[model samples]
Each structure stands twice: as C-alpha cells, then as structure tokens.
Target chain A: MHFVDMLVHRWDLARALGRPYAAPDELTRVLNPCGGSAARLAPDDRLLPGDRPGRVTTPAIDDRDDRRGPRAEHGGPTALARRTGRKGSYPMWCSSVLRRPRRLFAVAVLAVAFPGLAACGSGSGGAASAAAPAYAPAATPTATSGAGAGGGTTPPSTPAPMPGMSGMATGAPGAGGATAAGKPVSATRVAIQNFAFSPATVTVKAGTTVTWTNQDSDPHTVTAKSGAGPDSPTLDQGATYQYTFTKAGQYAYLCTIHPFMLGTVVVTP
Target chain B: MSRRQLARHGAWFGAAVALSVVGGEVISSVVGGTTSAAAAADDTATLRFVQVSDSHLGFTGTANPDVTGSFAHAIDQVNALPYRPDFVMHTGDLTHLSTAAQFDQVKQMLGGVRAGSVHTVPGEHDAIHDHGRGYLSTFGAGSAGDGWYSFDLKGVHVLALVNTLSLEKLGHLGPDQLDFVRRDVAGLSSDTPILVFSHIPLFAMYPEWGWGTDDAAQALSHLRRFSSVTCLNGHVHQLFTKTEGTVTFHSATTTAYPLPRPGVGPAPTPQTLPAGRLRAALGIREVSHVQGQTTLAIKDSVLS
Candidate 1:
C-alpha cells in the first residue's frame, strides 16, 4: 500500500511537470493534434515501448472531402506519442490543486485500506532502512532526504520514516550501474520517422553500438539530457548518428530541436 | 511543463483555446483593402505547377541533420513525376542561415528541376541578415516591390507576394505591397481563379509562434471578392488549412525538418518523435489535377 501510494505521488509529479508519466496505465493519453481526419485509436491500443514494430499508414483522410478517396501512399513511422492533456494553463492547475474533497477522499480511502498503517512502520527497527525505498520516488527534489539515502547505516531504534512524504525525485529506470564507458554498441538501430523515435526506450548490454538514422525529412539530434552520454551529430534523412555508450548507466536524451520528443537508453552491466 | 514555458503558453490558452483546432478567432471579417472579383476556374486547369516551400538549404541540425538530402529527394520526386508541370514554384527559405554559398547551392540544385521555369518568393531565411538584397539580386527578376510579383499562365492569375522581407511581430507585407495587391488585381475580371502564394501564412495561425502576417488581412481583403481563390504558403514547417468563404488557405509542410503543430509547443521548433517514427513524419507531397474533373483544390494539404 505504501509503495502504491508513493508510485501515485511520483506519477502525479511527472504528470504535473508535463513529463513522461509512464505509470503503465493504459487508459490515459493526450489526444494527438495532427489535423488528420479519422477516428483515433484508444490509448490502450498504442503499442508499448518494446512491443512489436507497429506500422499503420497515416489516416490522412481529408474530413472535408465527403468521398472516402484513396489515401496518400507514403511510407513513414507513426508519430503517436502525445503530450499530456493538461494544455499549459496555470489556472487549470490551480483549480485542480484546490479541489479539497479529492484529497479528503484519498485520505479516507488510504485509512480504510490500511487502517492503522501508523502502527506498521513504528514497529520497524530503524528509520534509515525504511527510508531507503523513498530514494526511488523523491531523490532529485529534496537535497536533505537524498543525502540521507547515501548511507544504509541505520541508528537502531529510530522510528520508521513516515509515509506521504513529498519531495522531488529523479528515479531514471536502469540508472547508475556503470563500469566506466563500455564499448561502441554492436550496431543497434533507432529509426526516426513520423516525427517520433521508434523503441522510445532501449535496454542494451554494455559494449554495443547504437546507430540513430533519421528517416524523416527533418533534422534531429540525439543529445544526452545529462552526463555520461555522447552527443550526436545533427542527422539528416538517411544520416546516422552513432554513439558508443561505454558505461553502465541510464542515459536520458531528447532531440535538441524538439525537446518534447524524449527517449532513454539503458546500458546494463 | 517547464514553469516558464507553462506560464508563457498559459497566458495564450487563458484568453483563447490554445489547443482548439482552428480556434474561433481565426474566422473573421475584412481588413482594409480593395475587393475585386476574379474569374472562375475553367472546366480543366490549362496549366499545372508544383509548389515547393521551406527547403531550408544549408541547415545542419539533429531534427534533420541532412537537409540537402531531403531537398534533393523533393527535387527528385518532382523530376520523376509522370506528367511534367508547366513550371515549379519554390515558396521560400531557399537557404538556411542565408550564406552566399548556400544560396548558390540551392540555385544550382533547383536548376535541375524539369519544369519549363521556376518562380520564387523569398522566405525570411533567404532574405538573410542582409534584408533580402541578396535574394533580390538572385531571384528577383520582373518582381515589383520587395520581390512580390504576378503573372498569367493558362488563364489563371498567379500572385507571388513576399511577406518575409519586412516582418514585424508577425510577418508584415508593409503598406507598399498591400497597395500593390490592391492595384495588381484591380483590372482582373471577377471570374478569374486566383492563386496567391507567400512564405509565411497570411492568416493568424498562432500569434505566440509568429506564424501569421500582420498586414495579410489587408491583402486577404483584396482577394475576398474573387469567386475562387487559393492561397498556398509555407514556413510553419507543417501542413494546415483554413477556408474563409471563397478563399481557401493551405500551409505546406517543409522539405527540411518537421515543426511541431501549432500550440503543441511554445514555438515552431523542429520535432523529434520516438525511434522508428521519424519516417512517418517526413514524405514528399505531389499534387495532380486534371481539367473536367471536380478538383479537390486543397488535396495537397492532406498529404501528411
């Protein structure tokens, strides 16, 4: 229950920041705004990151034209990733935040579900051990809490960390187990098509070569969002940007031109 | 949402439906300009041409690292078409970063088009830091003020206007060109099928991203009287369309890099989608029309 609660809060923060909030719920997806004239697929119907190579001719159906004519027979990837539905309105955020009953209901539900969870952690031997799990959800935002996560040593008899704690966290999946730059990836391929990247997330063993080819007519870059990844050359159509991930760590990246389009590469030891 | 990005776009969506497709404000009345009618289309188009916009030559970026390759592909698509167009029209942005060498490369590349002639309108990129003096020297043949011109072929009136030459907050055509539009079409018959071309959109697409032209209302007002008018433009880097009465506006996609849909991002920056998805975002658009057929005038707008 506590883990579930923590996941919800992290999901909330991710959604609020307009970041990728892959809580794995299949029902939610921001509607794609490309002016295509066709019915859209339900969110659950979208393929997951490692799902089968998905392809569908763009339903470039012209809504204004009454006759269902033959479509444009062009080949390209499906630009299916969508922004969250929260369309950048501060007032809307304020309103959603101000709704108090939802909070009360959440508390009521948590109380009913785990009745006396206040008793669960107090029985635990030390605070540090219980708090170690907190690092996964709220590590980046709160400096003090994150620093506390550095050591597993617990002062015996300290009470367990309380639930419902709030702080910023950066729990990049497949993160932080590096053996210093491994080797050039053994010819991995990432295709750039339909204004999107295929296999938005990739997990590869160390010592593999990753090649990014821009199949779109647009130019894009494979830029590391943080330390420990190679910056790619601006790739044109049929141009490939190669980067050898030498270390075992999760690397978050985005197209510098289109920052909203994001991807992550996980190098496993 | 970065706090700053959210705050900035929040203001736009607050007063308007930022996410609304073709928001209500886009529909409208006339601005100030002479309203003269144009001739209607004939049973068949006597002449056919292809419009290429935003080739953005010399651009080097991750969004589309190989700009020339795509431009060449577009040219190749044109060359390989079954029916030869009477001419090819390049809307603008013949060069990215507006270098002399870039312009020369584009000119050399464009010289390979199979059309009888190539007509051009300067995009802001072509005007470069020198304010269009370079563009005027290269492609400004028979053009009037700031590289805006008009010519007649196949009984259709084609007007190429340069809105990128002198831009304000949005694109600006200036009073001179607005007046030119007034006088240029004044003598034409009411039934002529007028085709207007420009770089930046003459309509307000998204003011936050500077996708609109400030004085385009004046130019559009002059075109209002025309019975059948089609306005084709490029520069937002994606395809979109809006129709006002007899006048229909189509924004062409780029042959360089794809830009975000209007209001999807703060500005019209190039887009990078998930891996294996970029090809879906890029493709060549070819338009075919035959006389004696019910032509879907805005067919190319749906190519994406």
Candidate 2:
C-alpha cells in the first residue's frame, strides 16, 4: 500500500515536472520500501482523504515566484499550498499537522470519528480562513481547487523544506556508513572535469557508493543510463551525487544534460 | 786458461742459466694463460643488444607523459654501455598514436644510437590509426610490403616479422607471409641460427588480451629445423620469456608505460605508474648469439 502511495507520489512529481511517468515495473522496483523507513501506502488505503475516488477534486497548487517553474517548488507546506491554491490550504495544513507528533495525536482521534473531516481545520488556520474567498461553486466541504487556478501563476518565491521528505543533504547515507560499506574500493580516483568524467571506467565494490563530484564551472548532472540504484539524484556543479549499488553490475551512466560525457561504473561483488 | 777461454766458459754457464730461466718462463706462461685467455675471449664476444619495444612516443598522459624521454634514457643506457652493443631492435609500437611527429621523434632518438643498426616491426598501435601509412612512409622500403624482412649479421639470421599488418584471426602471420618466411629461410642450412621478431607474441601468452598470434605455430614450423630459433615480441609492456622446442619467446618491456600482468585483473590496459618510478619500470634487453650455440644468452636490465 505504501509502495503504491510512494509510486503515486513519484508519478505525480514526475507529471508535475513534465516528465514521463515511470513505468509500473520501474516504480515497483524503485519505490519498494523493502529497507526504507517510509511505510508503503496501498493504492486503496485512505491515509489522505484526497486520495478517495470522486470524494475529492484535484488540488490546485500555486507557485507565483519560482523562476524555474512550478515543478521547481520543493517539499514544503507553503509550496504545497501554493500548488493547490487557496482551496488546498486546509489540506496542506492538515498534512503538515499530521506529520507533527503533537498534532498527530489530536488528529488521530478525529480521523476515526470523521475520516473526511480530518482534511479541514488543522495547522496554518490563518491561511485556511483567508483562502475561503477563492472557493468556487464546485468546492464542496471536501472539494479542493483543480489545476487551473494557479496553473499560469509565477512559482513561489521561497523554497519550502518538506518535513519528512529527505532533502539532498540527508538523502545520501552517512559518510562513515558509506565508507564502512566499502566506498572507493578501487583505490582509483576519477575526476570529472571540463564537463567530462575522467578515467571513464571506474571499478568499485557492490556496496560502494561512487561519488561523482561535478568540477565543471557550470551546472551538470550525473544521471545513470543503466544500473542506477533507486533514489539517485542529478547533481549540479560543486555538488556531488552518490549511488550505492547492493548488487554487482556494470552501471553505464552519462550526464543527462550532457550526453557526450559518458562513463561506466563497474561494481564487483 | 786464457781470459777469453775463462770468459767463454763463464758465458756458456750464463747462457745455460739464461736458457733454463727462459724455458721455465715459457712453460709457466703456456700452462697458466690458456684458461684466462679462453675466459677473456668468451667475455669479449659476449654481444649485448637492447631490445626496447612499444616506445609509443608522442603520447601525452599521466600514464606516461615523457615517453620520448624514457626511450631516450633507454638509449642513453645503451650508449653508456661499457661494450657498445652491435645493434638495437625495437619490436614495434615505436609511436603512441602513430603520428608522424612520434615516428620522427623516435627516428631522431634512435639515430643517435652508436649501435651498428636498429631494426623494427610494426605494432598494432602503429597501424591502428593510419593503417601503417605513416609508419611505412617513414620506415617502409627495406621492409617488405608489410615490413617483414630478414637480415644476417654475426652468424645470426634475424627475421623481422610483419605480423601486425598480416594479422590473422588471433594475430597471426598470414599464409602468404608464412610462405615468404619459408622461402626466406629455405636456402639457409638447418644448422643456421634464427631469431624471429614480431610485435605480438608468436606463442599464446594471453589470447583473451590479443597477446598471442593465431598462426604462430605455422611460422614456427618453418624454423623448427634450425638449431636455435629465438622469437621476440612486444605487445604487453612487460618481460616474459618462454621456451618451446628450439624456439624461445621473449616479450620486451615498453618504454612508454606498464600493463597489468596477464590475468592479474579483469582487462589489460596501460597502467599509469607513479611519476618517479616510471623510468625504473621501463627496461631493455641484451641478446648475444654465438655461432653453433644452441642457446642465445640474454641479459635484461632496466633503464634506471
């Protein structure tokens, strides 16, 4: 169930970002919570009232100040509010409060009594009241705004930090843990410079997290064309991306932004 | 007795004594000197030649930035020898990317050698880029169409094989070149000494890495009748010597870089050595073949 929710979330993120939805098999493999902390939410589960079929409309989120577009808005309640517009303000507040330990206790009792009512009157009560004026006729007590309200608005000016979403900083395993898992086993150092990865072939252990540090003055990405582990993120210059493979395979990767910069990581078990 | 008679008697006695002394000296010299002179002759005829292979000059990388310098150092070692070598033979890969500049540099550096002559064969690296055009342009004529040529010197027939060009399925001498070698050696007596040279090993050193020639057996068949056949090759930049029947295969070191030992790792490619140890890793060889000898004496030395 949680796996499906993660997949749905990922699919929504992909769609919002104007990317093709990951195939079902790819989603099943990548978003599998076999070893992760995120509990798998089944496709039928009603953890979020908005997930119920026909019970809730698509929430319209607005981002009026983001320069890169609406997809650039990161995880945060404010960004979620902006994405779903005024009508979604209450649901966004409820999700934030549900994520909090203190408010989760209060909402737990409320959740059992009235499953649909839990979406309203949670955190950020100020924004919820102010956004009530924008609610349209179709807006039921549960209905949220659709994609049209803030579709063309400028993205949010401020980036929001998602409470439970692991940001890039904490996305990678700890350095000591990564090292203990056999990082840099090849004793070979490959430097990515001038938008090109040096020593195109790098051999490492299966559990080793090969860190591709962007040394180019411009922003670049290290996207794997093959054998990339789940949660592998693109990195910018001066930023680093690490992938830890649990199984031995040759991971052929190239910068998605710069297809010419090709490289391969040979993971040995 | 007259003074003359006394002097004569004394002179006769002195002459007898002087003759005894002279005879003793001659006998001692004959008895003691033979072994020393024989040893000295053996030492004097101990011909040594440096076999530097796969110089691959004009390569610029951390693997081997100063390939030319390392090669020149090998030459310097050859020049600084107490007994200057008769000649030097580079098996192949005299250039890295096989550029004209690389060949020119190699030619100029090799020209500085005081040896009698320097023989060469083409390596895969030499032919891969230009299909051996630049190499042929620089070192063609005397070499046959594909650079397979043989010459006799100091009682040894040195056959430079062009296996790189006429490479078989697994790097071998094509039937045509094999026939050429057969015809080249058919006239020579069976007792004649033979030294075969090629870029890739005539024996199977490492087939997976393309180290061995496919039809080396066919090429070796022609020289089986010879008293001594020494096969020397240089594709892998390390020294490995193996003997099969009358043939001895010796792979020479590269002046440019080192490669992982066969089967030591997943694949074999030129490895970048530490900045300081690059010179010591490059080596040279000396080969001396005596007439009527079954074994060719070889001495290996590094540039450092």
Off by over 4 Å in 1: A1-269, B1-45, B281-304
lDDT per residue for candidate 2 within B44-155, as digits (tens), equals 3333345667787866656766777777766765565444555678888887656677788888988997776877888866774245888888887687767788887656
Query: Worst ten-residue run, lDDT, model 1 chain A?
Result: A75-84
List TM-score per model, in order. Answer: 0.47, 0.45
TM-scores of chain A across candidates:
0.35, 0.30
lDDT of 1 by residue, B34-148 (tens): 1110011322344556667788888776667777987887777667544466667888888875678888898999999897688889887786446698888888889998999
True contacts kept of each: 0.01, 0.00
Q: Give per-residue CA lDDT, model 1, range A107-188, as digits (tens).
A: 3223222222321332431232132211110101111111122112211111112121111111221212211122223225
Best by TM-score: 1
Recovered native contacts, candidate 1: 0.01
